[model samples]
Target: MKRFALFALFVLVAAVLTSCGLYNSKMASDPADVETVAVVEDAATEQAEETAEPVVAATEEVVEEAKPAEPQIFEPGSFESPDRCKNCHRDIYNDWKESMHAHAWTEKWYQQDFMMAHHETDGATDLLCGACHAPIAARTGQLPPADGSMFDETAKRGISCDFCHTVTGLDQMYNMGHVSEPGNEKKGPRGDGRSLYHGVKFNENHTKADFCGSCHMVIHPANGTHIIDTWQDWKTNWYGEQNITCQDCHMTPTPGVQETPGRAALLGKWRDNMPYHGFVGASSYVQDAMGNKKQAEMAREYLKSAAEMKLAETVAGDGNLALTVEVHNVGAGHKIPTGTTYIRIMWLEVIVTDATGKVVYSSGLVDEKNHVDPDAVFFRVQFRDADGNLTGKSWRAQGIGYDRRIPAKGMDSETYQIALPAKGEYQVSTRLMYRSFTQATLDEAAERTGEEYPPVESVEMAAAQTRVVF
Candidate 1:
């Protein structure tokens, strides 16, 4: 009867264990834990040779049950500060610190734009815009107000280190499809690396254009308009079929090549290649105003590299000069000015001077109020509002008015007619110029901040000079 009671007691204990879920399902998913269990069991068997085998086996099984699985994820607020990443990767950290990605949320211009869009939409697009600009705050449910009232200290970091490395995968190409876990297991290009602070895993998505496209492509929530189609431009173009991702251009020593050799971490070992963290793009005006000189220069270099300008055709006849200036999109895979195209400005500035240094004609001059000349051939997306009036505010846009931006590997031959009034050997100079903010928008931004605002910065992207003999 005692033997029968022992068997019944053991059965009851097993039943209770099953009901209480003592065996974790997550353990099976963890290969490291499984390997640990196997090693422990084998070691226990080896020790059992000199002791009671049954007792040793039972203890080993209990030990295995008590061992916890490796953590794969963390709660939203558990992200490490961007400064923490600087402790090891100072170079990358410094580079990223000055980038627009780092300033995406914190930039005053973006904040003003967000507030304006939210106000225009009656708080409808608060989350839609914030999802990309302030992703951490948006993911944590602090972005509905879009006034940045609910954001925490960490969320204000914008696209900080932890938020990016924690991204496991992407779901789609639009509307914040980046799925991040926000934990110590930082996914990057390094897989064999073992860090003192966090687990390292290789995530190839970091090197893909699709990943960048996931956030870079923005669509309007109200009218279902493709507000930002930078990614689509690249994906459907020659570059995408060639497998040249966005990382190849924005993160490389030379745009479109992917072999940047350096150490990604402070491991005292060299990696085959390391991508730059500057995230360089065509944001010279904005980056300069943000007090990031190096990044501004980098952005300037990128813009300069994006286009090439030359006099495709020139005519000097009948006391008049007609020139066809060819502007080619040589470097960029998408349109010249891709994101926030309405607010951004890209135009052709042409000037004709006589041999005696007298200005005969000039186009694309900035007015006293910092506005570009209305007659300049500006490459920008135009929009119409609900009330059928032209508007630059994207949230109020009902339809596209016109898209004059140059496509990738495309050319825009602009014909300028100038009257050769007493001209002796007229010299023509043409440049493609770009600026992020216009005077009207900057005025509103200054009014909102109640501080001294930066003057409108118009960067010359490309230049061409030729002398037309009349």
Candidate 2:
């Protein structure tokens, strides 16, 4: 009977594996390949630059057939799928289901970018991108040749339970050096908590911010430009000095909550800290468009907590209204609009009106196309390509020309001078606006997909108004 029971369990496991199209992977065995994280940080490194759009299938012509990417192989471990973990971690699983990480692999934006990279580089860039987008497939030999033709269902799960839990170690702060040994024995933060469903070993790296820094601190693969430096910024700031890890804000209920007491396992009693798994980030527009309402709201909440602004000075002088505004990065652990900051947009909009309601001056006016005015004080980085041309092509970025992004706990004092036609009780309104993508990208994507793209989510961080009396 015992033998029969074991055989039945084996059959069930085989069926699940076959149905999910699981395959053998050897990326874990080769630590070197796994460490070459594919983060294409493109910054405009020129004084004068033009806005360049990335080559996308929706806008650009796909004139090449991509050769399949060579699969990076590693020894497959006894890792259980996310569904199996859901048996005990129902709440955590549900939270992760609606997160951007869950859609990291199959999201339309990512798909467009990945396809563009594949076609541009003739499929050579697949594994680099796949290392973060599809770690399961990239490591399991499921995506050899970097093409998506051979991906299994498990690969579509994005950052899966097995891939995260199986991570055994990391090499450095940047890139994708996460070492995973997937299989029945799952590693975690719990020291003594054991599960009948799987084995568990406490991993100290799980408790550190650098653990999350594996894929967060991105660098240019060829030129070594520091593209995404959120981790590094925090490391050198007050937060890191106080030992405030990334998990404190991102993995907990509060954005910067230090820790919370809870049970690490299903049957265990309330112990110390237990991190949540939503893995939230600043991605409301995409998340809402992708039908994750809860995730979108959470993103909005994060943004609302990110910064605070106030109208510092308002004076009528020299036939003009001179005003000063103060914007402080108060809540976020990193800089506002941190990752993929080149594409991310943040700016200031100021409007001045007379007591009679006549418009005196206006900046940051949204055009009919839903784009911010070009001359507004924008907080964004512009990347340049190898030929010293400005472009949004992150994967091909070789230089950063201009980066106006606000840093952690930082403040920006912006002064605006507006010519007053008639300065009689002038009322000035100021606001700090945030959006995921520029209006141009949205329009291009809409034209290419033929599907009605969701509206550009322009969130207001803060607003204030003061009277300018002459």
**Whole-model lDDT values for every prediction:** 0.68, 0.66
Q: Across residues 296-347, which tens digit of lDDT does each residue of candidate 1 receive?
A: 8888888888999989545556776778888899988888888888777788
Compute the lDDT for candidate 2.
Answer: 0.66
Q: Candidate 2: how large is its RMSD? A: 11.5
| lDDT tens readout by residue for model 2, 213-288 | 8778665444445567677768877788889888889986555585667665467657677687888778889988
Error of 1 at 257 (Å): 2.7
lDDT of 2 at 8: 36
| Least accurate 10 contiguous residues by lDDT in model 2 | 58-67
For all predicted structures, in order, the TM-scores are 0.80, 0.82
lDDT (Cα, 0-100) at 33 in candidate 2 = 16
